[model samples]
Target: MGILLLKLVVGLGNPGKEYERTRHNIGFMVVEELARRQGVVFRKMFWFPARQAKCRIGEHEVRLVLPTTYMNRSGKAVWGAMKKWRAEAADTVVIYDDVDLEFGGIRVRAKGSGGSHNGMKSVLEWLQTKAFPRVRVGIGPKPDGADMIGFVLGGFAEEELLKLEKVVERAADAVETIFSVGTERTMNEFNQLQIG
Candidate 1:
């Protein structure tokens, strides 16, 4: 069997400048890194409430999308992008923040339940599948006394912010690796790295 070439990559996050630097927008951050490395600019499309960029990694044509429908409605953007590009669940990848893992960690899964992420849940609902690829960037667990909403919406601490800079870059590299290699190989290589 051949690897499903990635046709679309969606970065799940809330839009607007207010949510720009929050932990919940790490997915957005990773896509920005990808855009920078690929020299592509994302334009807000009127058809979908999202920003999109078109580019190629080697011979694979790819679309990078950032959903603007807040967190819960992220699936609408993914659905729109998938439809516009004629991409299937197996040909798309979603990158987002994960609070369950330690900060600076990266994990790639071919398919799984959403776990505790409402964004992923929204995606599963709209796409109607548990078989797409996903790249999870850990935002660390919430601190004691912090509510889930507040913690995810909050900005990273200064020290963690420094570390996150590298993690974001690595996440971008991981996405590229998925296109160059394949999801399973990328997962095995990245999931074993010890990042803070």
Candidate 2:
């Protein structure tokens, strides 16, 4: 069989310490975990603010990315990285936090609407395609009377944080599985999992 081309894994999140450990940045957390496993450091790239590491997983070369742009403007980084790598949508996987699913859960999709995620919205807009795969980490629903932005940007509670670690690891595993077995197979295995 021919060698499979390199794949881009983009984790969407805002830049800065303020967003660190927040529900909105679970994407970045997943990518960071993957980076740790590969021993690749994320360095800033011009045009796209991302940490890039070259590593191989199950026979496929992978480029892991964590966008520096804030959640709403994530497309700028994603589009630039995709173009720089000459990667197609099918070869790109975006990891992001999802408010619609319960906390600690994960959902993988081949392609779909962004739902209500501004980060995914920006990526889809910039890429001009929704055909790419994505791993959605559940951050749970917004609390009653809570501002949606505040809710997403807030750090996870102690219990939530512990559960989040497992979710992040699972998300990374899913990414590796996608590269090894293709999205359909990975989705079948991961989408049915409940993280909490």
Candidate 3:
């Protein structure tokens, strides 16, 4: 069969109002943007550790998910969603934050390692595969010798905050591109996006 179209889209982040605007929560921001565009709202699901929303993109029925498992153990919810929807690695796309790229930069990879993301580590662990598509929104540099946790959990700077909505909007556009076209094309078009 050809590449399986998107069935599940998961955004990794800690859950709660306080953590909503942190740099690390960009994944949540992007996916929430998608929900906003589609006019769908996320609701806590009983069968999984996630809040889920359903929407249509083209002819595909897509589910947008935010893990309620916080950041580190995000895999539990992603795996749960996959199982619930019978979606394989190829059919699911995981969106998350990355500290290596400069703030506002975005990267799309067809299949790859988890890198230094704790949330992605947990996802890779539970999914038992590296063959899933992922979108990484930059929140980076960590300011030399800074504590990684504090940096990531910190809120964006005032200037950064000003540009955040556009960044999230662009990333959401990238997700729709992934579904409308495919991962490789999305990567080709989005990987070079020079925001931040």
Write one digit per residue (lDDT tens) for candidate 1, span 1-196: 4553548988999999999999999999999999898999999999888999988886688999999899999999999998887898988989999999888999998899989999999999998999999999999878888899999999999989779889999998888898889899999989987566
Error of 2 at 64 (Å): 0.8
Best-fitting candidate, scored by lDDT: 3
Task: List the candidate 3 regions with Cα displacement exceeding 4 Å.
Answer: 1-6
Q: Roughly what TM-score does model 2 have, to 2 decimal places?
A: 0.95
| Window of ten residues with lowest summed lDDT in model 3 | 1-10
| Superposed Cα deviation of residue 131, candidate 3 (Å) | 0.2
Give the per-residue lDDT digits (tens) of candidate 2, residues 1-196: 7685788998989889888888899999999999999988878887677768888777777889888778899898888888898988999999999999988787888999899999999998998999999999999878889999889999997888678778899999999899889889998898889876
What's the TM-score of every candidate structure? 0.95, 0.95, 0.96
Cα misplacement distance, residue 178 of candidate 1 (Å):
0.7
TM-score, cand. 1: 0.95
Q: What is the lDDT of candidate 3?
A: 0.91
Off by over 4 Å in 1: 1-6
User: The CA-based lDDT of model 1 is what?
Assistant: 0.90
